[model samples]
Target: MRGELSLVADCKVVRFDAAFDITRETIGAISDVTLARRDAVTAMRRAFAELNGADVPIICLLRNTSENGLRDAKNLGATCCLSAHTPPAMVARTMMTQVIQDRADRPVRSIERGVARATEVLTRLFDGARSNGPVALAQVDASLEPIIEAVRDGGLTRWLDRVWTHDDATYQHCLLVAGVAAKFSLHLGFSASDRNHFVRAALLHDLGKARIPLAILNKPGRLDEGEMTVMRTHPVIGYEKLKAAGCDALTLGAVRHHHEMLDGSGYPDRLSGDSIGDTVRLMTICDIYSALTEKRAYKPAMPNAVAMAILSDMKGRLEDRLVQSFGEAMGNGS
Candidate 1:
């Protein structure tokens, strides 16, 4: 039965002498549906739910389909609906394409869903801050739970390896920064609580950017002096917002100082050297790396080697120890 189920997972023309019987036998298998009647969709959905595969994409074939057929396909999470008269090879090709596409899209969809949830939390925080209402740290913790879980589960690298962005650069950028920051923290011997705090700071480091105008935020080209000045206030803005919401000192420090350079050249306070602590230094490295690697309307993303080289060149601006640490963690042969 398991071998038969394996065959079904790979089959382009899936058939069931009796839909209920076959579905009962094929738990945990993803199969193309070359044949299904109106009632079959509901039965399949039930079976898929039982198999813990409710979201699995099913390819449906029918002699003729009405609006109800389409609705049924949607309910069953069908990937495509094909005419029964379609040639076997064509059906096979179509099913294969859908299977490949579904596999590719899963990670992307996961990122999108995660980003959307995180954005909702940020939006609410921004709205509350604007109104000067009390915001709870518990809410922030709840909002970060999914991101923290993904990072801890060793899934962050899988998400980052896929070169795509579903939301604005800010949301995607923050998520990547947190992942990198968490990774760096692990390498630097941070305890679990310390790592979570580090990741939280990375997540909210750009909250101040929300106060900046959208015009400047999304601009593809260079900003003039005035716009640049406006752009640099994000760290302070983020810090104040988190502080008002009762975030801890570490988070506040990272949010405010992530942009501060070691050479007294950064924005807001512009403190240099030891004034910027190790946590901020770690955040800065991750923040810079994520920003450089991300695609923007004005510039294509640089390769990792190129970005690392650029970071290495700015030795005085960034901490040498942290840069070396980051490079070690992220280095490949190139």
Candidate 2:
């Protein structure tokens, strides 16, 4: 059986007479397993216990096994079960399919974990804001690493695709911005410190929105003038809260001025070009791009090309050179 499997597969196949011979390390090292025995159900149970939480696929080939035995094997973690007479080629195909599927699912699982971690951090921070509890900068900083790593592994397109489906609009936008900022920083070859600061700023930029009334924050349509005025106060709200929590200068600046414009046309503070620091400038571009690309109840998500075009059109409002760099970072090119 081992020789047949080796002939069908392109990789080395190890044979073990007893299930006890398969160690956790061996399970981790192998792609898949083929367990053939008269007592296949018991063998499968033992194999699954050894697997613990590892995701290796297992195929059980049972001789004279009853339907109940096959069902028991499946319940015990067998990925597939077949009669012992089944051809080796068929088993090889099943193994290949499972391997391919596991590979494809890895990125998605990583993204899910990243988003979940970010959500936990954001929720704690936002809850702290509402209750005036102590805010932990360390926790917030740690949260960015998962997201940064996820973007690095999955690419910006895949990150965006997953984050766009997040349920909470506010959380979704923050996650989107942080992911884009991480990707942008990588593209520019920013140092580790700078990249960390960039993603940290993106994650906390909208922390002020936690104080905004939910009715206004989640409004389905355009805000009236009065609502718009209240809605625009998020940057200052976030800035002051984070400042009190002992955040650094770059974080405070981005939290306060991510909405500020280079042409002094933006709200909260109308500080023009030179007054707006580089952190805020880079953050503003990421912020706007995230907002435009994010799907909202009132509007469908904008296409990446259209959003880039909009940025290009804001020649006087956003830093022109930075905008070009941002275009390049997003793979839109100069």
Candidate 3:
């Protein structure tokens, strides 16, 4: 809601079908609209309310409504209209197009999901690393297998790559990290356990970034000295948060030292070379690549090729072998 007015908002494509989902207050010509249909007036109120202040134009897809609905929507202030019979997949494309045309916010709504599902299961396992809980590890193994296979055959990674482009800072960064880490692991010929390790580490590497003030993290320009110091502390902040939570060792290391480079130039302990754990090294590569490629709250994304070259140039700054592996992986597939 705030992004369009305040930050780098994608074009907004609100699903109008759920107008009455909140209040059967949903009425009007959109009753038959099944895909995203709920109530028309409710949809209008929410959409207009959001678009009222945002400079970005609204794209209202009315594919689910009747002819009367169309007239009603226009009368009510819908900008564009489509038939209820419009293909959902195509609707998705249209919404994305609208966002690109205006360079407004993305069409996806914030699906408020609680920390449940198997991802949480894995999170719990890594969270309680000291327990040596095989249960969490086993669940993760079973769950990640399909994900690994998908990426190997070029499924999950591609999907992650696609969605990563349009998500919020945290979601986008995590996906970017997951993709790069998976590719790095595959290139390293890691076993399933090692592969899962990279996946977990990459995904959760900056979970603590969620705790940082958005103002600091999303600063479009260069950070001033104090802000820079605060930003640098994210690793320690995330690390301590995890430590206090009693997370697993590898997970803790991932959150703590993903910023630390093989060269002493990294942060926190400033440990260089072999002192930094291998998992952290891999995550460092993932973190850098993902950040460079993903769009930020401040600006558009950097091209993959350009990002890769930068990483390559930073070889001496990171683990030389890890960089080589990462480069090779990128060259081989994506």
Which candidate leads the pack in lDDT? 2
Model 2, residue 288: distance off in Å is 0.9
Q: Let me know the TM-score candidate 3 reaches against the reference structure.
A: 0.56
- Please identify model 1 stretches exceeding 4 Å from their true place: 1-113, 130-136, 143-145, 151-157, 161-164, 332-334
In candidate 1, how many clashes are counted?
0
RMSD vs true structure, all candidates = 6.9, 5.7, 14.0
Error of 2 at 76 (Å): 14
Q: lDDT per prediction?
A: 0.67, 0.79, 0.60
Model 3 per-residue lDDT tens digits across residues 245-306: 55689888888888887778888889888788777887888899877877755677676678
lDDT of 1 by residue, 108-225 (tens): 5655555556667666665665566655456556545455444444355554653235357676677678667766776677877787788777778887876788789888878999
What is the clash count of model 3?
15
Ranking by TM-score: 2, 1, 3
- Summed over model 2, clashes come to 0
Give the TM-scores of the predictions, in the order they appear: 0.64, 0.73, 0.56
Off by over 4 Å in 3: 1-143
- What lDDT tens digits, residue by residue, belong to model 2 across residues 206-249? 99898899999888878999999999999898889898889999
Clashing pairs in 1: none
lDDT of 3: 0.60
Position 7, candidate 1: lDDT? 44
**Deviation of model 2 at 216, angstroms:** 1.1
